[model samples]
Target: MHYRLEHADLSLILALVRGRSLARAAGLLKVDVSTVFRSVRRLEAALGRQLFEKSRAGYLPTSLAQSLAEQAERAEQALEAACVSLEQGGEVISGTVRLTCTASVLHVLLLPALARFMPAYPALTLELSTSNDFANLNRRDADIALRLTDSPPEHLVGRCLGTVSYRVCASPAYLSTAALGDLERLAWIAPDDFLPDHPSVSWRRQRFPGVVPNYRCNSMLSVAELARAGLGIAVLPDFMSGEQQGLQSLADVPPSYDTALWLLTRPDCRALRSVVTLFDELARAIRLGHAGGIPA
Candidate 1:
């Protein structure tokens, strides 16, 4: 009666049957250990049969699992063929992948990466939504996501893509009229999300060293705009100021402190070929794009 086979869930079952341990199965699947545990439970619930019996030592395959093992093998092959049909059309690979990310990444990093991806995979169409808000993975709102955090939510699985570091930056014209000593006299624009009232803003406040701004604004775009208009000095992620004309790094921020940029998926959703293929391609694009050099 287990006619329902979600590709990702089915793969987890196959991995468990082969490895006999959730931890080991997760490793082979390139996902965290917790993800393997949840998938196994979901599989049990859906099939109404216990596939594995866990002991202190390891998992023992149930008679039911033994009976279904061969069928699972067939299912795996079917999933593979389905992926080929969805992502590749002869020479071209195409699918619609939706992603949620921060404004900073949407503008600075992803734009260029996609330009590279499109030429490589012309069949692919990307739907990117950017905001400070985090999407609920349980709702299946986004097929993939990029976040500025290290660990993912309990039900999600992912890896840190890279680090985002900040530096003190100012315009060429403003730098001429001002000095670091003019700290007290300078105007500063700060994102409300990173303001003193917010808990996450603690690091930003510590980094400024008493330099308060003449003007205040919220969001990265506003900060970039104000800096472009010759408003005042502000601490910005290096990539933001790197490409803009008026902005220049006033001081090389030591890289010791950095925030992680992560790539993620709903743990259960990983089984979908559409999601898996896109996640892999995007991760590759981000990695290769970084090696080429961070976009200005």
Candidate 2:
């Protein structure tokens, strides 16, 4: 007996192959663990072949299953290409473009560009996922990812928009009453313990080991808000230090992280008009706004 595989089956196989565990597969497919377990059992019964073997490590795919997954990946790529071709002929672009970026980037950079882009392309729907963690594009987690990094992943295609500069900033109110002589004496708002590995946080710890934070936050935007409220001084991206925010830079302690602003997306996703439009618009707006974006 012969069995035909549907798109869902193909996706399931690919996710399983990549994820190597039921939970991870479910996460990649955006489904529950039971769903993945049921699908695997169903596929095995329908095809009359074992796809994966349960091991102490995880779900290990058989050689036959690996081959099927490879074919499925190719099919998915072809489908994406076909969709892109069909979309290109149409004058109006309509589809959801998932963008993953840090909240700081959204607040300082993306919002202005999105405000204008949304009006121009009324048919397009934009979904923004704000997180410091990089979204996995290979599993279709997000169509586009905006990041600040020294090196971008080789798998994705994107443009390095420019350097994102960092600076120590505080409200004028906080600075006025504060002692100017000793930097360690000032109240500092630091990145949370969870983000100890964050470049800014690491930099602060190294530069001023004695400076204890009065407050801690994980989100860069929140840290900036605390600084703006005269709570404490914080290291913030240059874009956040806009004159309108009434925050002045502490020129005495200048620190820079050698990272570039990158707009990245999978090669297959780049062909879609929604992704292409937003990608170009962002690159243009960021470059224009920051004017070379202050070299890192």
Candidate 3:
């Protein structure tokens, strides 16, 4: 085995290992699926070892593949650290800050904060990536992230914004003819398996055992939209549902579910003035319930 792996090869392997699907890996790499497939095939041929096994469940990494992927992740982290080091040495406080969070959070929380912060620091540019998946702070996929978690990752440092609360909401049209006594009997729009561990899901399971939702969606925004359209009642964050038109919270379903909101940043990136300033502003906005531009 005289083969030497390149950074590109390692990156492909890492993407495949993490994404678990050719399409997903391609998306992450900003390439086509054919490109990913060809690259993986070439790497496997060069190493004379199978990296992944394909099945209906998607690509499963072999032991060697996992080891290589881990190395690639380490390399990524090191590169990010180096970048942060260089950023810290610079005196300029203006630059692009990449931020990531769930779509709901971006719209409900960060958007208002951003509206205020961006104008104040006109020289600062923001790149926002909204998704349900947690961005890899270690890889610098995002410079900052707003997350709702009970236990924040040890590797990251930031401030706890506040406690996020959820409530069951529905449109007035739907509630007019709806049965409010038995929650299990009401039409429900629930989060899909992607959010299986969400507080709302857990609350629903505990409150209405063995009950199935009438509709299910992966996006919290979609669930809220469907509820607002009179499709069904949805469990939504207070910030998301509070100011929506024609939507009313069910008094029967008390605000019993809550989670901690965190403004997280990589330790190395914390030294950057832009990151620190943004982090402080976001923390303040969230703590004061000012992020949504409405009273909490």
Candidate 4:
């Protein structure tokens, strides 16, 4: 505790909490595991406490680790604040922001927001990836992730931008042309990432009993299209739900439903220059329903 916690020390604590192997954590840092191990050993020696207890599963935290995590998180945040001061002479916030998310959210909500941000931070570069998997932030697959889940993995900092309502929707022409709406007659569009296990899907099933989706997809963008082309009714987020030109929200079915979109990053990463500035901008974009982020 005599020496201040460094960025590497903070990263080590978070990696261990995420339960990745020592080798995996080392690979993430592009260093050998022994070096990381030595760093931990050195830190422990400096603190005079056992930080981790080895188990078959992985290293589990001791009380000292828990304490260190809290202190380290604070230290990292303070360090990042110092970096913000350094940005004064740079004229622009310049750094690469790696973002991972679903395509629909990316296209519909995120892009619009970035449009505004990029102008202000001319030197900031945003590299976006769309995937269902929660991209590994600890390993730097992406610097930030926007996800439609309530809680994020431990050691990551999560902020709730807001929620997007879910509604069963279809094209108006399709609804008028087809003799559907009997609740038992229409086929549903199932997207892989936002699947049956998701609460939105559960809500749909509850609203319309005994109906199953015949068309399945892996992305919300696909499902939205399928519904727009009159394939079938699909349960979708409000941002995607309202934007489709001909779509009609099933007024009677379910109105009181919502899914939250969370902005997440490793706590230590949140303190990094690129991560904090981007997060602040991204958080603003999400709240404003900019950046193709679906409306809450």
Candidate 5:
């Protein structure tokens, strides 16, 4: 008996291996659970072998299936690389570059650079994903990422754009009679668990361990808005706070908190012309303080 495997079958196998469950694989494939089950059964019947075993934990791949999945992954990567090469070799650089970053970065840094980059490269299309969560570059979840970190992953290749400075700020109305020494006495807008290790949170904890925030939010933009409304003092990235009309940095509070901003990409993705162009533009913009006037 002769059996042939199709690209779709290989893709299904790869997705199932990665996802480890029919439901999850279906989600990845954007297909129904029943379809995934049917397809897997068909493949097994054709091959006269069970590729995966259903366990209490999830779908566990057999040794043979694992090998096949690895081959499928290699195929997928090679196909993607070919596509990227073709797009890069074209006269006009054109392709979707998926970029991920924290919401604050999107608002204060990437957006401004993107505004300039888009007009310059009209053929390039960008897909932006903003979240506080780190995007999985190894999994190709994002081709490029803007990150604020002291220790970047060694697996990725990128340039350190600049250092981001942080300061405590409040609306002029809220700070009218407030003294810098009495920061603990005033209400505070604090980041939630989403940013547990954020410099602002650490600074607040170290300076006023006993004080509890009057307001808590996960988003940096929300904290800024709260401070702007004269709600409370908030520790904000200088890039976000500097240009706001009503916000005033506490005179006595120095910009004590800082972190490195990095524009990172996967080694393989960096070879694409579009990725390289965007990466360079971002590094240049950040270094020049042109993106949201981010301080060098």
Candidate 6:
């Protein structure tokens, strides 16, 4: 056939393949779900090949589509490597790159990555805003945001780092004495009334309404510390606990609610080389499992 696939076509295919869902692909491509759907239909018609099979899980790519995606990924990697090469060639990368995320994210995930990142890019200054509230990217409140939500903002373009699963955890010292099957009977370290809408708090309310927490803290970091100190069992993201922190999971908290972690930025802001550079660096660190299996 004489048909030719454009870069856009390859990118669309690759995004769909990697993202595994129209919604996720749309998020990564910074387009509407309808746009991704239409592009898939158009591509299939032109190429005369089935690219994906839709299932309850997500889009499953065919062998042909997978092969094409592999090629697209190589192209993407080459471009990124070239960018890094240029940066290393003494290309001055200056200006502030502001980022916002929750305090827990800073302590458990972003800090280790940033510790290594800051020293390398001396010219690049970073303004780290730690807040539970989502910063308004539309108003340019921040250059980038690492947010945990099922629905990321449509105006921003970015990648879903990964899904974060919650676990009911306590220090081995606490778990040794606590009853495992009767979770409600156990002493609980919970989010404060200030965070009534938090997933863990809501989960507790729904599942064990009569269970009063022994410790309540607005800050997840504090809650974690309280749990680590063997105060009570706390529902925490798996990244926060586990063998590394001397915590053991007593039960698995359902991830039926908000879980997806996204790294988002304004479309126009991506045009800035420094912003893109930081974005790439953070993304790289997360995917490589710098902190935990969050990006895996």
How well does each candidate superpose onto the true structure, as a TM-score?
0.59, 0.65, 0.64, 0.62, 0.64, 0.65
Model 4 lDDT per residue over 219-292, tens place:
78888899999887887788877644467887433445556788887666755777788887788767724223
TM-score for model 6? 0.65
The lDDT, on a scale of 0 to 1, for candidate 5 is 0.80
Error of 4 at 103 (Å): 1.2
Per-candidate local distance difference test: 0.68, 0.80, 0.80, 0.72, 0.80, 0.83
What is candidate 5's lDDT per residue for 1-296, written digit by digit as tens?
A: 67898889889998999999999999999999999999999999999989999999899999988998988876775566567657677456656688999887888778878787677665666888887655567678998888888777778888777777788888988877666677778899989988899988988898889989999998998898898899988988877775454688873334566777877888887679888888777877766242331221
| Candidate 6 Cα errors over 4 Å, as ranges | 1-89, 136-138, 288-296
Specify the highest-TM-score model's number. Answer: 2
Candidate number with the higher lDDT (4 or 5): 5
After superposing candidate 2 on the true structure, give the runs of residues whose Cα lies further than 4 Å from its correct spot. Answer: 1-90, 252-256, 288-296
Look at candidate 5 and give me any clashing residue pairs. none
Clashes of each: 6, 0, 0, 11, 0, 0
Top-lDDT structure, candidate number: 6
- Candidate 2: TM-score? 0.65
In model 3, the Cα lDDT at residue 138 comes to 64
Candidate 6, position 172, lDDT: 90
TM-score result, candidate 3: 0.64
Q: Summarize candidate 3's per-residue lDDT along 116-208 as a digit string, tens digits.
A: 766655456678887655556767899888888867777787777776778888898888888888767889999999899988899888888
Q: Tens digit of lDDT per residue, candidate 1, span 1-296?
A: 64576667656777888888887898879999988888788778888879899898788888877767756776665555567666765533445667888776787778778777566654455677875545644567787887766445756777666677776678877777776674545777666545444222444566666755566666676777788777777777666776454688866556655566777887675766667777776677775123221211
- Span of ten consecutive residues with least summed lDDT in model 4: 287-296
